[model samples]
Target: MIQETYPMTVGGEEVLSERELLAGVEDGLMMDSTDSVRYIILHCSATRCDRDYTVEQLLHDHRARGFRTIGYHFYVRRDGTVSQHRRLLEVGAHCRPFNRCSIGVCYEGGLDAEGHPADTLTPEQTDRLERLLLKLLRTFPKAQLRGHRDMPGSVPKACPCLDCRNVFRAIL
Candidate 1:
């Protein structure tokens, strides 16, 4: 799936952009600074119980929650297609202390029957994650990959269960 273009349910082919980000829906608060991203924190969105929604729907929901913009920098679909969320080069609204220096990536559908993040990475999703991260590293060479738990206080809540170190070991 590491191709020049990606097929989308968004209706047509979306050429992967070398551009760091898109113009956010909000002009002020939504726009964060583009400092080099030092970390890539992975999270398992807890809404696995009942989510037939898309990344666009999730962003809309965040807007209603009063977010000036989307939270994560990228949203990985169950289908393995990644959608641009907030500006990757821009500070994100994902982590608290590290939000300004980290890039957040949200992968859909991993929670288990107990509502915990399943300790497994879907084959397709992992492959895409690897390819995308590799591409990002070329631009942000110093970026380090970590799980949501690795953040100063992110402390596990079921995410990146795939031995994160092994996942990004090659990139680092």
Candidate 2:
């Protein structure tokens, strides 16, 4: 049978409630629920430096790039530390119009700044990422999953990683 509840626990405890992502706890809004979730965009940090940037750093950097928030709804760190960067309720800063509809979960690494494969997005991370995506898909049933590169003009070099798309496709 399909699971009813999504995975909300991290490090074996409730974590989603502990976030101040998006506006705050007071950001009163709800995403429209339907039998299907339309899209899931795959992305990577494209940084080869290895766990050098903190969540706050990413937020600051993206803001420097002129986004209102950190962009992605969730970020899976190198250590498998999942951070709620933006609320699933609000429109995200990730993929423009697609951000409003798609749930963006970024793997910590997959490609270097040059879009070349690196020793990134480890096996543990891959497992957790798959579990997280599967969980999210159940909650948002209309999740017609895909990648950022699949969209028009999404990257300078069809960025993110190479096999990341293949991975998502396998799961979806």
lDDT, model 2: 0.64
- For each candidate, the alpha-carbon lDDT, in order, equals 0.64, 0.64
Candidate 1 C-alpha lDDT tens digits along 1-172:
5344333222132323322123222211322333356777887665563454487778787666545467788888777888887666665666777776778887876666566666545678778988887777666666778888766766555566546777768766
Task: Give the worst 10-residue stretch by lDDT in candidate 2.
Answer: 20-29
TM-score per candidate = 0.71, 0.70
RMSD values for the candidates in order, in angstroms, are: 11.5, 11.3
Which residue pairs clash in candidate 2? 36-141, 36-142, 37-141, 37-142, 37-143, 38-142, 38-144
After superposition, candidate 2 runs with Cα above 4 Å error: 1-31, 34-37, 49-51, 112-119
Once model 1 is optimally superposed onto the true structure by TM-score, how far is the C-alpha of residue 42 displaced, in angstroms?
Answer: 1.5
Candidate 1 lDDT score relative to the true structure? 0.64
lDDT at residue 4 of model 1 (Cα atoms): 43
